[model samples]
Target: MFNNWSELLPTIQKAFGALGKSNPKMVKAYMALGEAAAENEVLDAKTRELISIAVAITTRCDGCIAAHTDAAIKAGASREEVAATLATAISLNAGAAYIYSLRTLEAYDSLKG
Candidate 1:
């Protein structure tokens, strides 16, 4: 898993490199958000990491998943905790998708009738 960023495929490396160079102000803003979030007494680091990983997984952002997973581990989250967060994300996402499907089918059913 991203064992060698430097040795990554050229296209991937370029893409990531471009992302790193793209937006200084936005990057700073995100950094500020992270800093403020960390300072929130009600949200411990592990909690933050769990939420971050859940969002990353739901949003299908591989880079984010990697970054947040590492952060979670560093913040003293066990593997089980990270796995549980992912499971919760998957479950909730599935429920949301199913609800949308049901809504769409209901709309079509009404139109058909």
Candidate 2:
């Protein structure tokens, strides 16, 4: 982990506080967006937060991982569920890298020929 997940929420609050001091309107907008997306009723909180955690991992966003992991737990996700989400993220990230390497190989082959 990029940071202690336990400290995630507080750290975010602190960071956002600093950002808000500098750009209050932008911070307000961001917070509003988060609230809107999260409060949507189609998916339950647990599932939405679990998906957020997976996307955070896939995107390699440290802040997102920490925040979403905390949120996922709060939303009633089990440790096993988090593990499964992370495993899926890992698999997809690795698969994407492997597939993209084909383009690298193709470039090398073209240069050689």
Candidate 3:
């Protein structure tokens, strides 16, 4: 496992709490943004958490993955659901590279032109 997920969350929580104490407004704004995003009713809590986990994996945010994975499991996400979402995350990461490669080609052609 890449992370000791058991202790990672608590350690991250402490680090974030320290940051929040040092910069209250920034932390508050971040929390508010999360709340605002959750206000949208299109996705249920479980789905939102699943999406969050996917984003965390693709973005390489271990803290986010640990937090959101715990949240997802608590939200009643099944093992199958998590597995499928992980696969989606992997595909998205690959797709991003594919798209960037296309953009690289385009940039070269445009520069040559």
For every candidate structure, what is the RMSD over all alpha carbons to the true structure, in angstroms? 3.8, 2.3, 1.3
Give me the candidate number with maximum lDDT: 3
Order the numbered candidates by TM-score, best leading.
3, 2, 1
Write out the backbone clash pairs for model 2. Answer: none
RMSD, candidate 2, Å: 2.3
lDDT at residue 89 of model 1 (Cα atoms): 99
lDDT of model 3 at position 78: 97
Lowest lDDT 10-residue stretch of candidate 2 = 1-10
Tens digit per residue, CA lDDT, model 3, 42-112: 89989999999999999999999999999999999999999999999999999999999999999999999
Global lDDT of each model? 0.82, 0.86, 0.95
TM-score of 1: 0.75
Model 2 stretches astray by more than 4 angstroms: 110-113
lDDT of 2 by residue, 1-113 (tens): 55676777788869879999999999899889878986768888898888899899888887888788878888899999999988988999999999889989999999999
The number of the candidate with the highest TM-score is 3
Whichever of 2 and 3 has more TM-score, that candidate is 3
lDDT of 3 at 36: 92
Residue pairs whose backbone atoms clash in candidate 3: none
